[model samples]
Target chain A: METLKIVKIGGNIIEDETSLNAFLKLFSNLEGKKILVHGGGKRATSVALKLGIESQMVNGRRVTDAKTLEVITMVYGGLVNKNVVAKLQALNVNAIGLTGADVNSISSEKRPIKEVDFGFVGDVKKVAHESIDKLIQADFIPVFCAITHDGNGQLLNTNADTITSQVAIGMSKLYKTSVYYCFELNGVLENIQDKNSVIKHIDSKTYKYLLDRGIIADGMLPKLENCFDALKNGVNTINMGNTDMLIKANDNFTKITL
Target chain B: METLKIVKIGGNIIEDETSLNAFLKLFSNLEGKKILVHGGGKRATSVALKLGIESQMVNGRRVTDAKTLEVITMVYGGLVNKNVVAKLQALNVNAIGLTGADVNSISSEKRPIKEVDFGFVGDVKKVAHESIDKLIQADFIPVFCAITHDGNGQLLNTNADTITSQVAIGMSKLYKTSVYYCFELNGVLENIQDKNSVIKHIDSKTYKYLLDRGIIADGMLPKLENCFDALKNGVNTINMGNTDMLIKANDNFTKITL
Candidate 1:
């Protein structure tokens, strides 16, 4: 199977223009079939605040109201996605941006109203592989924003991490898929404060130990859970590291194993 | 030759939810291959006001400064384009939304600083036909937003009419293309106040005579020019009317001829 890289970037890198461009330059040099997934919560929140839309957050997850969903669609799917595609084009990379609605690539079910009503939020149902595969075969790199639809004309706000994992899992049947979660940190750190304390590898046993020992608690728990889920579900490999990890030959990043 | 309909809708139709959906319902029933091009200037301007971004208009044309361009990308490419695609998907019309940057479908040169420095505005240079043809062949309706790229990392604000015309001209090489300019008006009215004064057919001579007689003037001039240019090129035919004109086969619309 041909190796395909699925890289997911958070708002920290994207909110910083210089760093984003630096990362895109490195990404443009990668020599294989790849896809880029992005989240734009920082800019979305800022714009929401400017527009007097109170962003309600419960348990660190955004409550996506109608207005908030519109903001994210504009910021994530429009401004950030297009800018990234254009910049990659300038770097001579053939990149095309997409929302799940485009080509019906990703379909989701609107989250059920629970304790907190996350209006217009969606949990992904599936990622259509054939449409994506066609673009890939035509030599176009797919760039995705964290927005989806319910196949009933409703645009739903989704988590970028899940999008990355889902896309990785969906493409695993046809390719040797490797998923990378790129962020501001170096990797899963042994010492959270120390930039040099990068953990090179973690298996299922090691992950459970880390979580039980509280070394991998808090916000990192769900992220790592997504990484492990992808690996368990046939995605060949999963890694977490800073943006430069891909450009440099060294696997200085944290690797997840089954 | 297989006939392809290229429909362009202005902000008047898009800014209204009921009308937009009504039009999409008719568009969904379109028999053969089709493309939808749209502009969202009203929403963009409203968004700019809410975000404290002062919109600058010179001679009724928006001077697209950097901030204005960003707003339009969010409004047109993100908010409007995705909604249209999702609605079409719900209607079971496989539709994919695109900016010029996506698939490198449209490339433009930034308008040079002549008298009015229309910052970040672009005049289209070329439209890539093969990528679009591939999508159409794969049974996906291409929905375009009036946002293009300079092919050198810059996203530019472009006019929707010009985009419609240029795309029709480009696609004429592979298909018998028919361009439709859908707006609030029924058609080119002989009397601006009378809705029934639709000029059913207009050739070059009739068009010139109308303009010379002071009947066709103001905003309609540039729109007519675009239609004539498309017809002058390889585009098979051009029509201007309300959205219903596409559904009703009576052709109670203005047909531009050379």
Candidate 2:
């Protein structure tokens, strides 16, 4: 059997109804194998603000303090996860929405990055592919939120891209397949402002050269790093581009190579 | 100071974009006291079907088996809650999406109903209205999911109507205000098919008469019961009718009287 395809949707794609519906329509036609992982930082930030709570962000990652964690739990684990599942259903896709804590499907440890006490932030350490595989075998697509459990059984907020990459790598190792990072942008661009300036392909060396030249900044840096990591961890092929472009195998995507 | 009004929306209201937007528009203008509690049983049922998990219902209540519990968590607590919050936000209304388990704000105990093991279903035993009131005071509408936590700290899926009623009753006592159950229908009818044949008002006596006459059946029964319960719990007024009628105090609604 072919290994499953793991797709990661950024906060930008999942934030609005139009993009969400578009993604769902494409998702409905997806054949073979797939799993979806989504980010909820933007939604979380908006909710936090409404509640008069100031979100603390350090280097684009949310500083998940106790109060922020509560907001995140409501926004990510409770809100965004279901929204995606509902959209998938509206498109007639059989999607099973899940959090890592649900069945211990994804396990992690408190990241505590850079000695900053980011309360409940997690770094995913294990992916229970077998359970997810069973659901997929039963023809249900697993729609995952980026929350996970520390091995000692505490709920922690993990980065969505990291979680998506971990799941893709885990699935690839289990079945030896490829993983694709799908977003609103048309792959890694040679020039950020120009739509037609997408870099068609890049080796590990070229990717580092672009990063060194300051071509990737902000969110895209982490995304490219995640792609690089996924490739290292048994994932044979990694593609990053617009969701529709990926579905149609359009020439507007960047294929990361060894 | 005048007491704040807490308006609770049923899951039926939040099922689609048109109804949701309609409710939000009406809600936006109604300044003063407001809180939103929504149902997700319909969406949960649809998701359960898609996942090949049979959702068993006993006495019109979802018999949330383990798998069904998972589905409800993702659908009701996650998807439906966020969508409502987002819609409210888009209208520039500060809305905070929350689950009962988020801050131990709403606590319950799982009461296995009539020998059926409704895996994680809960009956509302206690509600901490202070936190919710604070949010309302800050001009933030707290949108809640019907999932609650057992005092011992287990998440139990509760009926949205029951939860909304409890929250309304609790808030009414604390703030001494009215709670309105707004729907698409004109209110409880003498006949379901005849829209104009609305029961103008009902008390305990008329409530029993309608039940005995078999006018109120199925899902409408619980809503009526909840309305009566809220009235009994010292809520000053209970309006059961269409959104426009409730907002404008239109004469077409069936007011539940003491």
Candidate 3:
């Protein structure tokens, strides 16, 4: 079976030039199929300030008001996307920056939650993998931002992790492979306070046990959920850790299996 | 009369980190009310290549197809705007980055040119100066991307020069002052071949002569038109050139008066 990798980077990784450059270098060296999706929270806040608009965050997520929506579109869709593409180009990597709004590659629905207006936030409703697969077949890495479109023609800002997971699951369904969720940390730790206690492998039953025991808390919950989602949706393997661990399958990374 | 300034920077200036730093330094030292609007055409093109999407440019303007539009939004509004704001913040300059779609401060109407689908491009149709003024009044520099809204809630990419001119004209009308259009060039030259043959001053008649002779071509045409429009719209003085010329009204700068 052909191997395809979907990588999701957070704002911390995307905002730091040195880290981004290193990631691009590794991306250039990688074989097989790969897709990159990035987050833009930090950049969006700065833009909000420049427009003299104050950003309102609810439960650690940016509330996309009309003003915030504009900033998100400009920053996620315009600035960071170009920066990544330019860096890859400098290194001779064929990469393309895309959002859900383009060609409707990823169709989403406006998630209007009761009592809380997320503004223009989107929940990924579907993924049209044909265009993405076509690009991958042509040896181009699709660098995506978390922004999406509601079938009604409005751009919606979605969470990077969710978008990446959806793309990974979608690609996994289309082409049997694995999805890697990489970060600066080593991997998901058995103890929240212990960095060296990497949880090597966890099955669906074990993952639920850890969650029930409160071993996985805070930001790690969403990521682990994404991993499980990918596993359930036909992904062969889900790896979570630093890229170094990914490159070598170095025993330290957490592997989610059926 | 209260003084107001609108500065439009080309993408080339922002692309160079050193130039961008120098611009920020000079920008921080300026007094009175001011706003920044910038362009990012080259960056957009670079990102397009990575996605394997070929950029289409007609008559020197980017033909923003759906994919190109996505790239533009990411590069211009997200990366460039945030970088500018971050640099300014590091330098202790209170700066804010914004797009026209934010706060409805800058609104536009879709261009109705037949047969040419300038997909998601806007012509500045309205300028709400009160919100901008409030920001300036609170001592923040507004760094803006040349993107706007099409009144129908869709985001539209706009021309930086046109956006600057419109904002300047609007502010001048509100505050009764002049607007400065600054660039890297040492003003408009009389002899295209001679760099030192700068036209220090051009009245309406001489400006028309230059246009008729075809010496001022392409992008410069819109720039000149913007200058003329600003002047006609009650902006009494228009200056074009480098920062040095703008600061001191030196020999290398072009001054237009009505």
Candidate 4:
């Protein structure tokens, strides 16, 4: 199988213009088949606040309400995705921006009203791998916003890292897929204060130990869960680091394996 | 060649949820390969105002300054586009919402300052019909919002009618293409006040007479120009009417011909 890379850029990278442009330039330089999945949480929150919509968060995940969904849909699906695509076009990368709603690429169900009614939030049901693969084979790089649709006319806010893993797992059948989780961190750190204390490699057993010891928590917890999910489900490699891990031969990133 | 229909919905339909849903259902029932191009000017304006961005318009064309560009990107590319796509997906149309930047499908250059400095507005340069056709043949209907990209990293506000015609003309090479202009008016009305005064058939000569007589002015002027341009450029037929014209055998439409 030929190589395909799935890169998920977290909200922090997307929040800063300079960092986003820099990341996009490096992303454009990445060879072989690739897909970009992105989140725009910070921008969405700010935009919502400007419109007088209060944002609520529980744990690391957002508590999406009606107005909040519209904000994320506009920010993630429209502003961030299009700008990134235009930048890639400028760099001669054939880019197409998409939400899960486009071409029914990913379908999810509204999270049932259980512990928290994450209003208009979707837990992804399926990824249309065949459809996306066709676009990749035709040489179009897809940039996905962190939004999904329930097949029955509802748009749902989804976790971007989960989207990345689902897409990677789906595509792994056709390619030696590698997943990259790019964020503000150098990598998953043993000590949050010490930049150099990057945990270079982690496996299932080590990850369990880390969880027991409370080393993996908050935002990084859900992200690592996604990484391990991808690895367990046929994805070849998973890397967690800053954008430098894309263009640089950096040893300061955490690699996840099953 | 197989038939391909390009339908451009004026912004009014999109602004009203009921009308847009009615139009989408009518659109999905149309029996062939089709593309839907839409404008969200009203919604964009409203959203811009909510975000405290003043919209400046010169005639019917938006004067897209830096701030206005961002507003449209979020409104047209994100909110309106994604919502429409989700709705169409629900209708089982397999709609893929796009701006010209996606897959490098359409490339435009910034409009030259000839009397009016329409900042960040794009004049249609070329349409990548082949890339679009591949998706069409793959069973995905393209839903284009009136946004285009200059190859140099800028997303420009484009006139939706121009996009409709240009795409039809481009795809006419591979398919017997037809263009539909659906707006608030019944058709090209002989008198602005009379709904029954729709000019049913308009040849190029007749179009000129109407133009000289001031029957075709304001917003309809540039739209008619695009119609004639497409007709001359190998597009087979052009129809201008309200959304009802899509489903009904209505004589309340002006059909353009050479």
Give lDDT per model, in order.
0.90, 0.72, 0.73, 0.89
Off by over 4 Å in 2: A57-61, A205-222, B1-258
| Candidate 2, B1-258: lDDT as tens digits | 366666767767777768878888888777776777777747777656755788787767557787777667766786566556545655656565666654345778888657666777889998867655655554556777888766453567887777777887777757766667777788888877898888888889988888998988998887777777778887777777877754665678877877
Specify the poorest-scoring 10-residue window by lDDT in model 2 chain A.
Answer: A86-95
List where candidate 1 sits over 4 angstroms from the true fold.
A205-216, B191-193, B205-215
Cα RMSD (angstroms) for every candidate in the order listed = 2.0, 18.2, 18.4, 2.4
Best by TM-score: 1
List fnat, each candidate. Answer: 0.86, 0.13, 0.20, 0.86
- Candidate 4 collision pairs: none
lDDT per residue as tens, model 2, A1-258? 586777788788888778877887887787777788888858778666755678777767558886676567666777566556645654656565666654356778887657466778888888877756665665667788887766453567888878877887778756766667776678888888997788888779998888899988888887777777778887877878888764665667888877
Error of 2 at A138 (Å): 1.7
Winner by lDDT between candidate 4 and candidate 3 = 4
Docking class of 3: incorrect
State the TM-score, rounded to 2 decimals, of chain A in model 4: 0.91
Q: Can you write out model 3's per-residue Cα lDDT over A1-258, one digit (the tens) per residue? A: 688877777888788878777777777677778888888858778656755778888887668887778677777876676556545645655565666754356768888688677888889999867756765664556788887766553677888888877887788757876777778778889876788889988888888899899998899887777677677887888878886654643678888898
Docking class of 1: high
- How many angstroms is residue B27 displaced in model 2 relative to the true structure, after the best TM-score fit? 41
The digit string of per-residue lDDT tens for model 3 on B17-103 reads 887788877776667777777887577676557456787877776577766766676778765765566566556555556667543
Classified by CAPRI criteria, candidate 4 counts as high
lDDT of 1 by residue, A2-48 (tens): 99999999898898889899999989888799999998858999899
Docking class of 2: incorrect
Q: Kindly give the stretch of ten consecutive residues in candidate 4 chain A with the minimal lDDT sum.
A: A55-64
